[model samples]
Target chain A: MTREHLRILLPVLSLAVLLAAVFYLQPRAMSYFGLNLLFNLAIPVALATIAQMMIIMVNDIDLSIGTFVSFCACVTATLVQDAPLLGYAVLLAAVLVYAGIGAVIHLRGLPAIVVTLGTSFVWGGLAILVLPSPGGASPDWLQSLMKSKPPLVPMAIIAATLIGVLTHLLIKRSSIGVVLQGVGGNERALERAGWSIVRLKALAYGLAGLFGVLAGMALVGLTTSADANIALRYTLLSIAGVILGGGEFTGGRVSPIGAVLGALTLTLAASFLSFLRLSPDWQIGAQGAILILVLAIRLLVTRREAN
Target chain B: MSHITTTTPNRAAGLRDLVQKPWIWAYLAAAAAFGATMVISGGQGAGSLFYAALTFAAFSAIVGVGQMFVITLGPGNVDLSIPASMTLAATLALKFMDSNPSLILPGLMVAIGVGMGCGLFNFALILLLRIPPIIATLSSSFLFQSLAIWSNRGIRVKPPEPLAEFTTGGAVFLPNVALVAILIALAAWVVLERAIVGRWILSIGQNLRAAQLSGVPVNLVRFGVYVASAVLAGVTGFLLASFSGGANLNMGTEYMLMSIAVVVIGGSSIAGGNSNVPGIWGAALFMFLIVSMLNSYGLGAGVRLILTGLIIVTVVAFASKKGYAA
Candidate 1:
């Protein structure tokens, strides 16, 4: 690989190896859990990571994705009972509503971070309106289907791989992708070039919405019941993954393909923490320490390069 | 740019501004709900709205004002650790009391000191390390939370019985705690408006590089702003502890989003340069009332989050729009 390519792929390779090791050590567990760690906890986490990484790449942030996930989950869980078809419809509708909101905010030329946060509140509010006490139930068969994990290769993992591949294509070869990278690099220069900055931003938000939707879907499956707090941590974890993994690991310009490895690595780390049997307090402390260490290292590396 | 119109904002302009802005409508809506809440909660009087406004106003205003400092003075920078700092300071102060088991007046010193220390901690990380304030504060916040959680271990500490007299069920016109918060607001107004240091803050916020060139002690001002904000948050926490009857680790996290929302919706630009303490105060009352309304509706956590997110988006989006326009 070229040097630039190596910078991107190295992290990816390391994470992939980590995942392999995790699987090897817990092969029985993976199998016992239907051969898909994605269905376990990583799926939602990975999806949230992708959502966050996309926005971070564009040098914007979203504090609302977590709530968005909760909002959609709550709605789906509530609607899923009694009318299975309508529940699916509600799920789709929620996704569209969130996406539409993202698009409007992007088009308005406001900072994505704050706007998304506000929209998150609205969506979360709507979620409360539907099911105030987390009483909704998922269809019994939907849980069975979700938990089944598709014998051939664990469908959720397959789906994630597909997303990673598509993301790879978009970042590497797409026209808007170039525009997005350009905007993040320098907003003024890009705007001066008459590049329709608004459209590009709207598209970025749409990608964020997609990732959030995927995360919500998987999180709903994992919990067997949707609640408001389900994916709240995902917002922080996603951004942390992006920064720690290699997206911001390279000032937010590393390859999208690498992000998958980054996501896997992060999931592995969390699983590792669990494996190590840390208490909840320690887990939180561990997360803080890990972020600080990674950031400190990244800053050191950047300074050395500057030197 | 100019003390957010210090001489009592043009009532006509302010009213005009309110009508034109959706957030004001939101504020009014929140007030209407507060009105309904007062009537339903068995507070039978015209003064109930005013009382409810005062009750919610001070804490939210204090935090909102703190948020204003971080964003405006620091240039769209956020101190995510405000809540953490507030909790740490509040908890530490109360913990100190628990140690000495002080019976009188020690609470004030302990609480304020803890807040200053927390603020000073935030100031050092952001200024000396030159880390982005948001990231630094966020990590510090988590660190603070871990420490708080570890220390508290779900334990709660309450004020001694005598101190409770100053806070709960004692006054109809004004709670003593509310008076303390008002004094804080007055002090902040002086520090951020009339003082030369205040001018330096606004100037730096208006243009950091220029301020640096002008011998404004850039690091000092930057650090001071965060310290100031921390002090405000710390005081808020201490009072909240008293009002709620104690201090706990989880209390401050509740303030983070709502506080930021109150500040942004109050019309301060995220990129900084809007000074209107009264606006911040008014905005806080409205936001608290709004949340209380939502709660009264028996809204679930999901709904609360979504609504908060939505409010944040609309308010900040509008601020950016006005900012760019101006």
Candidate 2:
């Protein structure tokens, strides 16, 4: 197989193996309810991973996405419940701010990681200011929408499939998608071709912000509440998921379906560990181990390709 | 040509060059923060405040120097595992020492060993697995943090009495921790300015492909830098645990950001290749004083965090612009 095909296939194959392992360990997990329990939280993770993918598409990374999602959750739980229009306006402004940050980063040639690192603090601070102790209630409609069960496949699977297809169409098939990825692949070539790098980067960050906001809302919908530090671990998790889905940190390589599957794999991995009675402390270590193992496999595959 | 002039003119040019240097901003900011704190307190407790700033800033400076070395290696090179390594080293060392005064030396050794292990693992992942340094360090940090939590379950362990006293005590009106950090900074300065290894680092950062072809021993230098960073973090964690009376699971959390902040604010190139030891100290002191000043003004944590983030962005923006101009 070509490298691209392998990249897409690896996540699917691993996810299948992981699913089989989970089913073997707990035969009950084969049921729709068990699947829901396994994959319900995976939606927000997938959303966040897709959001990070957008930033990576522009050869940048958003370290602030976790905190930004937390901030959005705070907005959703409190403001959206009490004042719908004002809350939405605030979220809209946040996406614009993200776009502006992208522009500033490009204009000044500042490191994206450093700049986003700074913004993480800003977002975390804002989240705290919005909801100091995490007691705000999610919107009723959101809660209902998230809790509703569909026929046969469960709501989680339906949502995942919808997200996978929509994002694939938007990011992989669209003309603008090609141009955006081109900016990451070869900035000089695109600039020489009269495409504006600044605009593309801004668009990429804005889309990331939009997805991050959606992820936060979905999380609050599931949990029915929000906290400042709720999604802090999502930053690392999203990056890992993207990589597991065959997304490179540079060169604009990404697969939306693979990313969604990657998120599901991670969620299932956590469930599998819990079923094995692993300590909570070791769960994080297992995450690191999984990342290493996947990367090692990729290394082996690449070496064989080279030979 | 300027050096060939008369000594007086040469000295004047030297002073002028120092003024124009980007590192000057950090010192000026530190001074301004100190001045602001003094004003806020109406001149009361000046010595105590200054001493506290120095003591706290020392930990940041210690870790900041190590981060400086890694960052100086090049873009996309950073040790995100510093905080985790610090926690793990301190936890393991304190557990091994078991608060026994006689085992203090052995405790220090354990901390350093843990640091070296973390660094070696980080490097192995980067080299053997071909993972990017950013992701490698980040993932490794999870393992370190988990090890720390698993080992002690977040229990706070006390240090030996003598060690604690030494860490917290001062000699000649200067904090003992500050003294150690200053000594480390001086050694780092010597290495970066006078050693061939430092030159290799700079050359590699400037252009990796060219440096590799020109025989820079890039991998060895990288190995040394990563190890040095982790070792420093280890030592800092040891002293920090002693000074604070115990080691806690969350003790190293803030330093992750603090280390990087001081490096950038201290006038080091965030893009790598250029750094200065003096800037690290100034920036460290500035960071502590800035927080203290904001606290004295009765600002909430939310406000303080927002302002801190904004100030960091502003400083980085200005530093990058200065880099372009120079």
Candidate 3:
């Protein structure tokens, strides 16, 4: 198959395989595990994964992503269902937190991994300071959307698809986005080309921050309340998704759409493992194994290309 | 201004010039403050400063060694798998030894093997598949973390007698761990600085292209440094297990961030060239003091972790940006 054909086919085939596996073996989950619920939970995670993939495409990182999302979720949890208007402030604050992280990385020349890790701690600190527990109610509107049932498909899937499609379009067209790919391809070369590395990086992280805000907004609907560590796992999972979607550090490519599919595959894989009722310890092992396999496959393909 | 020169002899001279440059002192002072806060935080007690400094230096030195190797490889590379390697090594040691005296060396060997295995995994990816060093290490860490948790299944196991400390009816006030850490650091210093292998490793980090042209055995030396780093982390992991006397799944997560912090805060540049044994020792002292001071102050886990994160960023902010191309 051509690269494009395989790219499109992989996600669809994955979904099909997952469906077949679930239907064939997990007949109980089919009845108990509603597709609607899965979509609601998975969409935010999938969106956050895309957010992660975007920054990684530029060869920089957003280690604060997971914590930032949780901070936003805490905001939505505390005020969204209470004051309602305060939700805007929380969302704005979360977005700014990521933007601030970007600015810090730019200004200090500190490794993004270190700088964002600090901000992640700061964000987590703020979250714990605000809501020490997980017991807030979302506004009825938010819950209603999350709990919505569509005639044809779940709104959650629709929302995720819309995000994926829009991102695919935006990244392909924007000059800033083009510049980001160029920088990731060769940072020194890009700097020599008269492009502002600082501005380009800021834009890359800014977009990631926006993704955090979006995931936070979606999450406000998912669980109807925010827990402090809700976004913590996404930090690793997002990177896993990006890599699975064929993203590399010395980057020339990232299939954003493929990233979405990879994320979906990852999420589905987790669900599949949970359904099997194997101990959760196995999940860590499984994740590691899958990543190694994917990376190895990529290595083989690149070797073939070189030959 | 001096004209640009590109000879090996000239480069060595430039390195000597850098050693004497005022930036060296300034850099050392800034690095000292990062550790000093920990010592000063102890409120001037007689032995508190000593204890704080030793602990601070130990952790810093262990982590600094790990970071220094990656930097010595030069390029924008450093290990993120240090925590995973440490945890896996400790967990395996604790689980298998289970307070048995004779099993200590065997356990330590196993732990070192695991560490080396992780490093070899990383080296293979870097050399064979040509993955960026960061990506390679990051991916390998996941494998390491999984193996760590899977190895003991999150159980708290006791260290063998040889590895345990006085607190656990083992040694005197010093603890066997302190000795072990020192020995590892000393041995590493010898292997990485004075040995022929060390020179080859330094060459690879200084300029990979030139090193390759000069037939410095680039891949083998680069691979060996990472392997050595993993073994060092493994020994540290063993000490931590013995000191704490309990092995938990997240046992080494703190070290993951701490080790890098030590290397960066210490004088070792991540852009690889010459090793920074003394700087790593100093950094270990600095980190241990800070953590002990915070512990004395009754800070919670969340606050302690945040403090660590903050210190790391602050350290990076102060350190010279002589990474890559330097």
Model 3 vs. true fold: TM: 0.84
Determine which window of 10 residues in candidate 1 chain A has minimal summed lDDT. Answer: A243-252
DockQ of 1: 0.44
Q: Which stretch of 10 consecutive residues in model 2 chain B shows the poorest summed lDDT?
A: B1-10
Per-prediction TM-score, please?
Answer: 0.83, 0.96, 0.84
Can you list each candidate's DockQ?
0.44, 0.69, 0.45
Of the candidates shown, which would achieve the greatest lDDT relative to the real structure?
2
Interface RMSD of 3: 3.0
Model 2: pairs clashing at backbone N, Cα or C within 3 Å: none
**Which one wins by TM-score: 2 or 3?**
2
Taking the tens digit of each residue's C-alpha lDDT, what string does model 3 give over B27-115?
45434554555455543553545544554356446656767777678765777678788888888877878888888778878878878
Query: What C-alpha lDDT values do all the predictions have?
Result: 0.67, 0.88, 0.69
lDDT of 1 by residue, B1-326 (tens): 11322435457786576555433533554556667666666665546556666776777778877877778774537777778877876677666666233643677677777778777767766665555677667766777777777666666777766666666643777756667667777777787778988788888888888888999997887777787787788878777777777788778866777677676676666667555455566567667666666676677665665665555566566656776776
Ranking by lDDT: 2, 3, 1
How many angstroms is residue B74 displaced in model 3 relative to the true structure, after the best TM-score fit?
A: 3.8
**What is the C-alpha lDDT profile of model 2 across A1-307, one tens digit per residue?**
4777888888888888888888888889999999999999999999999999999888887888899999999999999989999999999999999999999999889878878878988998899999989689999999999999888998899999999999889888899988888888999999999988999999999999999999999999999999999998788889888888888888888888888988888777776787777888887787777778877888898899899
Residue-level lDDT of model 1, residues A136-247, one tens digit each, is 6765665675677565677667766876788777876787777777766776788898876666666676677777877776677767777666677776677666655556
Which candidate should be chosen as best, given DockQ against the real structure?
A: 2
Regions of candidate 2 where Cα sits further than 4 Å from its true position: B1-12
